[model samples]
Target: MNNKPYQRSELIYKDKIKKIKDSNIIIFGLGGVGSVAAESISRNFIKNLTIVDYDIYEVSNLNRQLYSNYDNIGKKKVDVLKENIKKHCKDTNIVARGEKVTDSNIEGFFNINYDYVIDAVDDVKAKLAIIKYCRDNNIPVVSCMGTGNRINPQMLTIDDIFKTFNCPLAKKMRKELKRLGILSLDTVFSKEKPVETVDKKLGSTSFVPGSAGLLLASYVINKIAFEE
Candidate 1:
């Protein structure tokens, strides 16, 4: 086990670095947001990770996905991210599941005793299910909302779902979560109004999604390193 890889983090965290290494983290979705979040967590000395994603890298994903590039455009996102994480954090134990997390299979995915679960999946049904499952089970979860259709990285902030606004996705999530009796959740959301696009397709940039992922990573890492 080469602790040298996280030497700088070890300085501030001291022996608490071991706590991070022992953490069991699961991230759903390996697109622009989840890919960066997974990479950031792995580099921070998280040893165990279960990454779930069924998508393949397309040329279009190169704009924001950390594991997407021209060379791996046709490859599976979970496999690509697992290989990349292993290359950097040799001691980390990463399990890549190339499958989508839906209501039908959600129970199987959360069977393991994960210390942290990141809900980066965009589907409203899946996202709400994961969040409700975590809340009901008393698990720590951080959800990312609407990194697309925006340009400002500064507008991204971490807060409960009900406290977020200006992003359409967050607004919808707030209503859904409230109906489910879930009053609070840690979420990364942008306060910027989405840009008007003629085609009505979500417009995204390289930085917006990347920044949201980083913020989610930082939030999780800090909680593990300090709060734990």
Candidate 2:
């Protein structure tokens, strides 16, 4: 019997694991950031997770998306991510919705009780909807802005979403949120120049997305386990 006592040792860090396990987290968009964030959070021993995404793994996604693989190219991003989580931690409670985040589904999608939300979608419209809903509900959320174009992952930083200037996506989000009377929120964004694609390829070659995703996950886990 492989009685390594994974469950018992987990109790040694019970207080910490309890804090994370008890919290409910929703991750939107299973793109570069979303995919990586999901993997990072799973390793942190979070008990409950809800992942939302309407995308499937593409050949291009193999570059940065954690769930992308040559064999799973056409698989839904959420499905693969959920499977990966289960493989790592079989006891984890995972709820996956293979649908896009939009105004129509936002309410029902986020209706479940969530302690925190991680915004990893690339679409500005979807990101705005998520931010607004979370802000209104006072649910803590960390959004990723513009991980598309950047080579240096070290330049990524977590800051007040409103304070993220010079980032093209952040600039747009700032204006939109300001118009909605929302002052600030948390975000992971890089100060490095946006990564450019020569032929408008489908995914990013830079390390920014993976780094930003890990950073976002780190912030959420820290807040849930220690700061809370």
Instruction: Return the TM-score for each candidate structure.
Output: 0.95, 0.90
Winner by lDDT: 1
Query: Distance from true position, residue 164, model 1, in Å?
Result: 1.0
Query: Across residues 22-97, which tens digit of lDDT does each residue of candidate 1 receive?
Result: 8999998888899989988988867688999898999899889996879998999999888888888888788989
Give the clash count for model 1.
0
List the candidate 1 regions with Cα displacement exceeding 4 Å. 1-3
Q: Which stretches of candidate 2 lie over 4 Å from their true place?
A: 1-14, 195-203
Report clash pairs, candidate 2: 149-194, 149-195, 150-195
**Ten consecutive residues with minimal summed lDDT in candidate 1?**
103-112
Cα lDDT tens digits, model 2, 85-189, are 898677778999998778877999876688889999988889989989988888888899987657788888989987786588899998898999989889898
lDDT, model 2: 0.82
